[model samples]
Target: MSSATKYTRGHATFNVISKAILAGFATACLLPFILMIIGSFTDNTTVLVNGYSLFPEKWSLAAYELIFKYPKQVIDAYKVTIFVTTVGTAIALTITTISGYALSRPTFRSRNRIALYLYFPSLFGGGLIPWYIMMTQVLKLSDSIWALIIPSLVSTYNIFLVRNFIRTSVPLELFESAKIDGAGELRTFGQIILPLITPVTATVGLFIALGYWNDWFLSNLFITTSSKYSLQYYLYNMLNSSKALQELKAISGDISIEIDLPSETAKLAMAVVATGPIIMLYPFVQRYFVRGLVIGSVKG
Candidate 1:
């Protein structure tokens, strides 16, 4: 009957209720994706007949088989995507962190002006033709993997986020102390600043990785050779070709040839295949990502 016991019970009850609510919302968000995966495994005929039920009458692996039939193409695309994502993320993080740290420093005389210059492009960008000419005719990066990695190497928005995070998260006294201890700029940045802003670093890194992984437009514009296609572009071309084949069959009545086209189920399977590996990365970094966003937003 004590007041303290009642307060503990009430707080515990509220906490449980909150967790249950969040769990429900999470399930709600996840259910459609789960159903999409299950639907992909379901037979194409069953999907056509039943219209995408979670529990279908038949199961098939036709979609996955179709994808892996071109093993060399798929593997090559995977290598390209992995290389671009890894290299792009590393380069992006380095540039963003360095620029951010410099901008966060009070002693940097032109930090504000340089920040404005960086921010300007995000608000106003040159038209597509100019950029295309610049990349192709000027830089001559077409038909190469460099085209994908180079253009998106730096994000002004990410730089500002990191700058704000560093300004608000790290104490000014730490920098002064490091300077007094005879540490050079590089030494202080490497030994002191980098370690302190790990959360934000990981957060920005994840963003850059996702951007690189999901990018297909850049590939469409720059890549002419099939050998250089990224995974997203490969999948996009796969889906488009499949659709075109279906249309050809419908229009030409090509039952004589017996062509096998990818169904709706197959498209869903492609999505799962393309996205599954990248999705696995989120769980490993989810904690830091959430914490980083909270600290960055609240502190800034």
Candidate 2:
């Protein structure tokens, strides 16, 4: 065979192998979400009894009916979650951006020390007991929306991401030119840096939004009242109350239990409601996020 033909065949084989590897990785990443979506619709009794099934053999809308029946709880949860996600993302992004920009400035002497002060918390969260006591006894944050907001406002990882992105991407000349034109740091940051960093900002903001939206741990611990539960916490109760029901049944054995628990279908509906907007909006944001990474190449 000719050398040219052999090289062409090798290139074709390499391309095919690369595509197959990428496809496999994509499938691995997507399979869990697909299972969750499918499981939400599958008969829970069947799933509990016979592992997860790809398709629902016995379908029912009972779960959705139950959620709709007590729509007040779900609606309230949505309100709280939306408020938290929006406000939390806004506050987090603002702080992260400002801090990151300040830290990225080469002349800042306290940047490293301040970064350590912020970053150390992520490595070891004060154990729940001490943290809880601090928030509740010391700070009096229990039973308030501030419980969620305050704890999550400053993420060490976010600060680092913003700082690195700013350092690697944002142009120094732009800041210099702005300063030479007599623009103060705050004005330059507000008007110039912020506009240019929208891509990274959007990326970080979306991450914060998702974190707040999907958070159940904070609500579960901090909120004792029904009215204060976020969507994830409320949905969690609706989705997984089977264990509690089982315990109740075991306690009072030999009696027919008829507590209306959320059904598999309703779980699917809830999942859809929870993630629908994010999935819809991600494509738009992703476009810019990609551009941000691409545009912000190495800085000297």
lDDT of each: 0.86, 0.79
Backbone collisions counted per model: 0, 2
- Which segments of candidate 1 are over 4 A away from where they belong? 1-28, 48-50, 255-260
Which tens-of-lDDT digit does each residue in 1-300 have in candidate 1?
455665677888997999999999999999988987998788888888889887789999986787677678878888999999999999989999998889989999999999999988778888889999999999999998999999888888788888998898799999999999999888998999999988889888888888899999999999989989999998898788877887787899886533556668877887888888967877887787677667656745
- In model 2, the clashing pairs are 63-263, 64-266
Quality of model 2 by C-alpha lDDT: 0.79
Report RMSD (Å) for each prediction in the order shown.
3.8, 4.3
Model 2, range 1-300, lDDT digits (tens) per residue?
A: 455655677888997999999999999998877876776666667765676777767655555576678688778888998898888888988999999889888878998998899888778776889988999999998899879788789877777777887787787898889989999989988998998877778778877787898899999889988888988887787667855776687898834664564555566678766776777887777775565455444332
lDDT against true structure, model 1: 0.86
Error of 2 at 256 (Å): 4.4
In candidate 1, how many Å is residue 66 off? 3.0
